[model samples]
Target: MFLTNVLNESDCQPIKKSYDQWYTFMDKNVEFWLPDSELHTKNHCARVLLLALLIGHQKGLSHEEKDTLGMAAAFHDSRRLNDGVDKGHGIRAAEYYKDFCREHELPYDVQTYYITSYHDQDDSFGLSEITNSPVVRERGVLLYKIFKDADALDRFRLGPNALNVNMLRTEEAHRLVDFAKDLLQKSNETNS
Candidate 1:
């Protein structure tokens, strides 16, 4: 996939650096994540990053936008370390990003704030309400949409036997159902 290729590319230094830092952080704090009994460790954050990259590539986002999306995806779930009950993970993530920017000597901007805040929004929050807000519906908002859809796609991989049907109630979740079914079929054929 082009998204996979883009992720693999070494030229995107900022995205690569943030991803490395986040992965290292996650490795040291894996126990903080919500438990899922499934065989996969259920690193929703990593999956969300991958999904965001895929969606960004598929949507033909500009290079700068892709990097911003990637950074947002990498840090969006960092607040999960504290049990994720607090409704301000986005703000927390933004604070982390501020630290990151200072350490890396990177430029700070409103896009970073928008990306972090929107990415951390509760999934149950209605898209219509989000879209109705000017700040929430700007170009930066597209990054969150891509991440949201991609995260939904990964969750859909849990088949009917493994997941509650109610999990796929959202429009994006329902859309991913078909894609997940196809991927499952392909995997089965390969295994057989």
Candidate 2:
């Protein structure tokens, strides 16, 4: 998660500051379905969170908007039963997120809901069937794309060729390609 060298100063400082805070929040406050999993737990989610916030910084999303990314990151992969194409895990995670927020009395965001609900699906399917509502597309599309790209960035953990840059939905996501690799390597090393 050391970005001071890889990321430019403008991007590094804010995200570096935010990273530790969000990671801590996720560790303490968020719940994941596979806490012991190598692929889908906070290790993965935290990296995605960093990637999302880094892209959010470059895209000029507001702090509040970025907060939604944090919420999405905290819960997006929190409900996977298995690592192999768990089709409805996003839906399960979204439902769990709704209940978590209600019981905790925290404000629930619709964009976070949409982002979590459709993240494991293809953009064509997700956008056309579920995430494409005019309100969601208009208000949540960029965030959705950012969150998806962020999650996709972590595909390095699956393997090197696992990520296809062309599939990324944002220019900012493209910029973080190298950072994502290094982040995965470094974070895994640190965890190990």
Candidate 3:
């Protein structure tokens, strides 16, 4: 009931028809969480979805994959609350996703779980080790990578003045990083 009023069964009927029956159930409860001020917001999630869609399209993902990625982007930070405790938001979000899957009688794959659970971990989460695992390498690590990168891009957009160089890890992600740095530099120069 999280997305209860925001998005309904009709809005997700197409997704349900094309993918799995559980999509409708997932969509209904996906947006239930309230984000904290310091963390990302619905606006941030939207921006990340847009960016992820663009990147995914450029990467030539199928329509189904794009839809899945878009859904993930929307629900990535769905567990954040305004109290400033982001400790287990990803895990909480995954739990929500699992519940939705269970309610609709869908297959809950491990990759899907990790994709949602670690969307925000960044390099600090030691994802590289897991990603390097033969199993993950064989799957689609790129999907998760792009999702994280797109989310980071929007984070920089939300506070261009506060982003540091250390936040960037890939050349593709650096494009947004440089853009934010340039904006901040221009703002400082204008003030001076």
Candidate 2 RMSD computed on C-alpha atoms after optimal superposition onto the true structure = 2.5
Ranking by TM-score: 2, 3, 1
- Candidate 3, residues 115-159, lDDT tens digits: the string is 677775655573774475565434347777767777766555446
What's model 2's TM-score?
Answer: 0.90
Instruction: Give one digit per residue, the lDDT tens place, for model 1 in 1-192.
Output: 112333354433335544455445545533323345231232445555554554565567777776676566656656554543456766777777777777778776556566666654555463444566665436755665665565556554455554443643344444455554544454344435
| Candidate 1 regions with alpha-carbon error over 4 angstroms | 1-42, 83-85, 122-137, 156-192
C-alpha lDDT of all candidate models, in order:
0.54, 0.83, 0.56
Task: Flag clash pairs in model 1.
Answer: none
Quote model 1's TM-score: 0.56
Q: For each candidate, give its TM-score against the true structure.
A: 0.56, 0.90, 0.63
Order of candidate numbers by lDDT, starting with the best: 2, 3, 1
Highest-scoring model, TM-score: 2
Q: What is the clash count of model 2?
A: 0
> Number of the top candidate by lDDT?
2
What local lDDT does model 1 show for residue 172? 46
RMSD of each: 7.2, 2.5, 8.8
